[model samples]
Target: MFVIDCPTHGSRVLLSERRIRALRNTDTGVLLALECYCGHVEKISTGRRAPARHVPE
Candidate 1:
């Protein structure tokens, strides 16, 4: 769970896993595509983790 300042909501909004549309790993952190209860889509990054490495077959 994470909190985001939604422009439409005008305050911190709680985002659950169910609200997540997609997740992507970046150099800095994880990018999350979330949809708010009011149908607003926003992207937020949280925490830093190493990016995944691909193993060639």
Candidate 2:
């Protein structure tokens, strides 16, 4: 599970593994594609590194 800042929801959103569409490993962290309850898609990077900019689709 993971938590992300959802732009549409305007707060922290909880995401379960079932909500994950894709996951990619980066040199700094892991990139995750998550679907929100509102059906919004967002990409987030997580790990020991700094979080990347959120990409919404």
Which stretches of model 2 miss by more than 4 angstroms?
A: 26-29, 47-57
Global lDDT of each candidate = 0.77, 0.82
Q: Residue pairs in steric clash, candidate 1?
A: none
Model 2: per-residue Cα lDDT over 1-57, one tens digit each: 878778799988988999999888889898889999998898877788846565453
Compared with the true structure, what per-residue lDDT tens digits does model 1 show for residues 1-57? 866667899776888889999898878888888998888888766655745644222
Identify the candidate with maximal TM-score: 1
TM-score of 1: 0.65
Q: How does residue 17 of candidate 1 score in lDDT?
A: 88
